[model samples]
Target chain A: MNPKNHTPLIFTLLGGLILLFIVSPLLGMFLATTPAQLFETSKDPEVVKSIWLTLWVSFAATMIFAIGAIPLSYFLARTKFRFKGIINGIVDLPIVIPHSAAGIAILGFVSRDSVLGKIGSSLGLNFVGHPAGIAIAMAFVSIPFLINAARDGFENVPVRLEKAALNLGASPIRVFFTISLPLAWKNVLSGLIMMFARGLSEFGAVIIIAYHPMITPILIFERFGAFGLKYARPVSVVFIVVCLVFFVLLRSLAKERKSHDA
Target chain B: MMLKLNNISIKLGDFQLKNIDLELERGDYYVLLGKSGVGKTVLLEIIAGLIKLDSGKIILNNIDITHEKIQKRKVGIVFQDYSVFPHLSVKQNIAYPLKGKKLTHQQIESLIHEYAELTNITHLLNRGTQKLSGGELQRVALARMLVTKPECLLLDEPLASLDVQLKGDLRNLLRKINQKGTTILHVTHDYEEAIALSNKVAVMHDGEIIQKGFTKEVFQKPANEFVANFTGIKNFFFAEFSPINIARINGKIEIHVSNHDQIKNGKIIIRGEEIIISENHIDSSATNNFKGKIIQIIPYFSNFELIVDIGIEISVVISEDSLFKFKFKENSEAWVSFKSSAIKIIP
Candidate 1:
């Protein structure tokens, strides 16, 4: 056999190891838990409520925060100013910090004695043990993904196109809506999906701020601590299957839109 | 004047354009010719209101619009890259500027078809912009800009990225557009494009307009050495002129020139194609003649360029037939001659 033929086999073997490492745990959990157990867990009121809360809260956080983040991303991508690099570094700071540390940081900012806590008090809103608090924690930790992705998208848009639109008698705002936003929408959509996914998987931050809201991650941690491995396994399997279905569906939708656009 | 730039000045980082003044009458096609990095695009952008001038006044159609916003300026520009919107179809790209004009749907459709047909991209209306050819993209960009009926059109090197055949086609399109009555200010580095496209030409050097006049006059009588060399005059020499119409070059060779009573010392330019070269002296009515040796022969397009050194190295271009008839070779003796009228004196 030619030595070159062996190269692909060698690469395949090496690549297969990492793929096995990622797939093995999920496969083991699914295989260990019977379908009856998964079905029973899906019917449980607590598990069903926790999963629904996790999905809706994370999605709401992504949609609400995106309003502010997208414009900030466009500003960062277009302008050159003093301390712009420092601002970009600050945006990425949450991703580098430990999740529990990010949780602690958010806790301090909204801990009833801070200025925001007082403002929330005046507005009849409490941060601790509330869905609003959980949404805030999710947004605080996952927003960098959206900002970075959208900024990259805006940077790839040619400034000359915007100028051309302006020369054709379109106002600046009109150019943004027609030219800049449409071209960058794919990246922006990808960013939103990533933020939502990251928010769904969040545990350390949500538990620290709003333990009573009982998102799926916190509930799984509680069941494992209380009833040991047997009880936690079924919930984990159900959550994984739900997440996989959502991820695959969202990605397929994105791909279908891309093909349609092309 | 349809448009005028009065003492326009702008500074961006290390580059600055200083005191640029230009005027364009109605229905005139003007070409701003310069080499790369001479601030030609910057000037075009400033005129279109895409860039703000640090100090200047812009007057269009007898109104001062020095600080008007870009959308209200009524000036359109087509960039060299032909920035057609990739997300829109060719028809949609052309229809983008017509969205807020309050026109009826039928009116907008008719206008899009009209300009698209004018630019010869009518067949590409429904197709997406990604797979279009360079010429097609250029036509789309022109259609997009022309659909709005702007007062002036600014083209930044419109023909720079095109192949030879595409460039010729687009040149004809631009000429037709100009004839239908739109003032155009075109920027290009190719002198041939200026010669073929514009009635008025200006040469820019290092952020300033060095010379501007009618196309024929500017090419024939450039203001200085830089303009002369840029406009393709191959032979230049600094000389001193006496009262007898005799100019001495480098204190070595004396050449007879046309009489200029006021020019006592100046530079003289002789076109390379005007000089006659032969193996022996021929009896002719030419006023200047010299016996020289051919030092170099370079292939220039279809003709051969010979550098003959009599007292100075003078370049002469000869046809292939002459090259063979004289059997010109390196280190061969030849006679070069030209009339007095062929020498242009610039002081």
Candidate 2:
């Protein structure tokens, strides 16, 4: 061990403390709930329904909003325009504001008295206490992760590569599809995963918007408040396990795609 | 003219290119030479339609392409860094521009192989670009651009990033490409590359084309002092001309120069290789001769640059054989001689 190596070791020790701080509580909860309890919670119809709703709603929000977000991110990366800094700040606003405040702001925009609410009412689609409202809240709170990641991905691509493609007689749109998008896909995938995971774990805004069709997070809170920690622990363990399996699966898929592209 | 830049001018925030004009004939290998940051690459980008021109018309093959889209301009450019797509195989990168041209898959494949063979990268066609050497990457970039069969090819400092042997090989390749009837505009700051690869040359300074002509003519007679210095002429002095073709340098020495347009005052340039050194005065057709002591001798490539104090320090390059034949050494007295026609007068 060299004297110069001591600083990195010290930093590693500090980092390990925070890592343990995060893992210990999750590990303790998993150990406290037995397999029998986890199986029972998984078999409960309400529990299963909430988990399904949570997964599908968040996935739907991520997929639907990504179409618009990806193009906006590309524009933000490549073009120069007035107030670009302000637009970038607005994109990151959702990540910094409190979730309850975000929910209130969304409610004010989509309430029955608002113009959009009136338009939805005309279409017989109620946003309050609806799955639509749940999706909107999840999208609002989690979209920043996707935008920032995709923007960074686009920024990392060398501008000269795109210029070379154009000089070789490819159209601008063709260059974007064949050159820019493929090079930046890895970061885009990571962003998609982050957005989906963040949306799945959302509770504050989703509860305010639509509590009838309970997501797993809201259900866990409800069970803890009513029947104490014992009842809530089983559901929490099941949810965490499911989320972990999906996260691992998505990350491996991203890695495989990256290697294949390379 | 196959291509012409008609009074092109562009402004790019704090740096501006002003009123640049150039013309190239068909099958011409033109070299644009300049120091770094003289807008050489920016000018190449404008020709390739990657940069917008604030004012000027770019006429290529008698068609105005000033407002044309890049894809429609029929021009290709190979950048200094190669910019080979990291996510694509060498073959796939070569085939990129051919994908949407309504060519059959077999046709595209055949074209890719043809260009790959031309650039001597046929073995590396299916390989990914991550681990290729710099020379291999350059070949890949060349094949990708050449496969498109562009009307004109623009190379931006193509040889600046290669080793000496690689530079020679690529210079030969560029010559072969030009001989096969592809017009090329190569941008480099290397005079050797300019002399080896281009029949015509243009020197750029401070965002303007200062001088352009046949390579031999431009090297022998530059338009100004900057061009003379840039072309590697080491002997320069301010001189006042008399009516009898005599130039007096700082009232120290007088040398005869070929008369030109009765110019009153001008700068005199002498190539180091044209000046000769001898142990004693020799009888010859040479007009100007002086006795001077050698002040310093700096070894150049296979030769020595002798700085002789003939009233004014003048640099002279001589072969090793000549150095020993004259018995030249530091602080040794010798006679220096040159013809009157050897001096270049830039007014």
Candidate 3:
């Protein structure tokens, strides 16, 4: 029986290998930065401002995803639509497309000449070299995480609940808010958490649009390019720490939302 | 009270509802009876305003609500699966419709309690509905639907998923609801259920209502062969017209018929379970008696249905008590007798 546990043994080996692969870089970042240098860099105002900007921008993007992405995801989940398979494929396109390509596509549309950008500019909003640019970049790469997550959550919900509400003389919209949203809230929350975390780590796209906003990822890149990995190491370690806390919280939430077999 | 559907036609995939016309008066418990994929549930949904009909007019209470949205229609529906919300507890689920109304928490609670006690699931008020058994969930679902007190209620096979034993109790509960002027449009495919509960039955096949009338009338005198076959009327045959009312099976054999109501394009129905069989001809004045050979004896619980050949194979069902009393073996000669009233004309 002990020897027969090869499946679990194989699983353990695979998990251990993946953990090493993810943790080794963070370990190297910490090793590259001495304690004095890490403490010295942490005192800098530029570092603090960049961290706050990254945190707040990610939070704003997550809120936006919650407002817009949730309804779309729920619609995709609940309805038997003609283009549902295609719609889902399109939502997932951002995840698979090269992040640089995604950055270029978003840049082309929000470049003040396109209809959407023109409207935004008329409303005294500009995407170029502003927080809006970083927001758009983060949104482009990370909204798929939120939509797919919320969609999966809505899909997990039993549609009978919606029907029950309607048959009880409640309106369709009433049923959606009262039953569907609350039931699938945890899934959406996890999506938001992941999208926020993904937004925090975004670098490739943000560089194309708003490098001066100096999101934490850009700061990490700038420091490494100008000074060395030694200077960049401390910032990388700090970003890693902030992201780890959120990652743990997301994992816990996912666990909480999972159905127990009973 | 007056619910009328005028020429309702809807195409859903291959099964299309050609033109269904039905009316349910106040205090009428109408059950839509049909086989699978006959558009019975779809019809219920259309009436409830859940599904938009391709073309039709649904006039409820003299209101032309053909274009009304689902919420504005004010009709309640209990889907075939009961479709209870798993997230909301019984109390909350029952209170779902009451929300956004002028009712307070206490008022909602009282309504929930009132409907809950009526459905006899008051003890399940606080439990998550996902854990409920099919019967309990159905009661909660019913309680929720009744709490709203919509103009008309549509039920789609509330007993289909329950075990055979539970159907009787659920059916009786449903009958009591029907008795209270709910004007239920119940949908079911089961024949016995329609016989047991329906004041009016609309027979649907391949998405069209072939026959609709008083329950017993439709069962006793089917309008067509399809309906006759549907309602378990087993003794069906066609014979050419004769000068006398004797349907001649052969040169020497003929069966007597007197009821002209039993003639329709020269086709008639005799229920398999209604005909009686005996070894020697009985002295009773049963209108039709014929000498026949038993082709098969099919056992059905406490009785056996015997198929006999008197030129044409005619089935006669006999009780097991009669099976023992008459010592007739299979392939033996027997005389089959039935009354004229038992024969029904099928258009």
Candidate 4:
């Protein structure tokens, strides 16, 4: 064999180690559990409700906050305002900060005595131990993913395209919608998917805000802490499978749209 | 409509536009000619309402549009790179500006088709702009701008990105567009393109309008040394002027200087194309004749530049047929004649 052929072999061996590193834990957990255990966990109403709550709250948070987050992202991408670097750093702050600290921060703001809590109380609503609180926690932690990705997308949109649209007598708002947004759709889509996925996986913040609604991660933690790994492992296997299915489905749909566009 | 810019001034980064005053009559094609980074595009953008001016007045068709929003200003601009929207099909891109207008869907569709045909992009109407070639993208961008029927059209180096053949075609298209009575402002660094497409020309240097007049006047009689050099007036000599029309060049050649006003010493500029080359000495009404040897023969587009050593080196542009007729080459002896009227004295 040619000496160059060894390069591919060496790289493949090195890359396969990472692929196995990612795949091994899940595979081992899946193989360790019997089908009967997985079925039983799936049948448990609390587990079913917890997983459903996780998916539903994550999706709601992504859809609801995207309306505001995407526009903020476009503003960040398009202009260099005073303190722009600081504002961009603030956008990424949630990712670097400890999740428990982030949870504590949210707890202080939406707690019963905080300004938002008072407003919520006046409206006969509460953020503590409620699904609304859970949604807020999920959105707070995951919105950075959407904003940063969408900002990158908007930055990639050529400024000349917007200028050309303006010269053609189209208003600025119309140019944003018809030219910038459509061109940056792929980045926007990926950001939304990431936000949805990150929101679904949030545990520390949601556990702090609302413990009773029991999003799937909190449930898994509870099962492991109280009843040990035997009960928690089966639920974990089922939840992971469900998430993988949805992620794959969403990604495939995005890929289909991309190919269709091309 | 006639457009006038009075006292336009702005400072952007290292470039500054200082008190630029220019006017364009209705239906005139004016080229803003300058070197790169000389604020040519900035001037065009200011006129198009893309760039806000610090202090200026823009009067178009008797209406002051100094502070008008870009969309309300009846001006269209074709950018240098032809920024066509990549996600939209050519037809959709051209029809984008017509959405808010009172036109019906059929009217918009018909207008798109009309401009698509006019710009020779009818075949590419259904294709996304990303899939089109460079020339195709340029035509689509032009059609998109023209479909709105803007009152004043601004082109920023529209032909710079094209091959020579495509540049010629687009030039003809621009001419046809100008003939339909739209006031056009074109910015280009290429003087050939400027001279080819302009009735009036404005030369900018370091963000100021150095000279502005009819194309013939600006090219024939440059206002200063920069204009002379920029317009390719290659023959320049330091000379002293005595009483009457006599002037001595390099203390060697003496010639009759026309139109000497004041000051005794200045630069004399002679355009290369005005210098007549001949085989032998010939008597004529010309003021200066020199017998010199060819130092260099540079072949340019459709012409040859003979740099002749006449005390000082003087470049003369001549046709290829004349090169063969005189058998001109390096070290070939030739006679050069130019009138005093052709010697534009800059003091």
Best by TM-score: 4
The TM-score values for the models, in the order shown, are 0.86, 0.87, 0.82, 0.89
Expressed as tens digits, the lDDT of each residue in A1-262 for candidate 4 is 7899799889999999999999999899999999999999999999999999999989999999999999999999999879999999999998988887888999999998999999999999899998888889998899999999999999999987888888788888888888888888899999999999999899988888898889999999999999998989999999999998999999999899899888
lDDT of 2 by residue, B82-128 (tens): 99999999999999989999999999989998889889999999899
- Candidate 4's error at B12, in angstroms? 1.8
Two-chain DockQ for each candidate model: 0.73, 0.75, 0.47, 0.75
Regarding TM-score, does 1 or 2 come out ahead?
A: 2
**CAPRI verdict (incorrect, acceptable, medium, high) for model 1:** medium
Clashes of each: 0, 0, 0, 0
Indicate whether candidate 3 or candidate 4 has the larger TM-score: 4
Over 4 Å off in model 4, which ranges? A1-23, A43-45, A111-125, A259-262, B131-133, B240-264, B279-283, B290-313, B318-334
Ranking by TM-score: 4, 2, 1, 3
Q: Give interface RMSD for all predictions.
A: 0.9, 1.1, 2.8, 1.1
lDDT of 4: 0.89
Find the 10 residues in a row with the least total lDDT in model 2 chain A: A204-213
Q: Write the per-residue lDDT of candidate 3 for residues B191-287, one digit (tens) a residue.
A: 7788889889989998889899999899887888888888766677775446447655434456676647544246667887678888889878688
Q: Which pairs clash (backbone N, Cα, C closer than 3 Å) in model 3? A: none
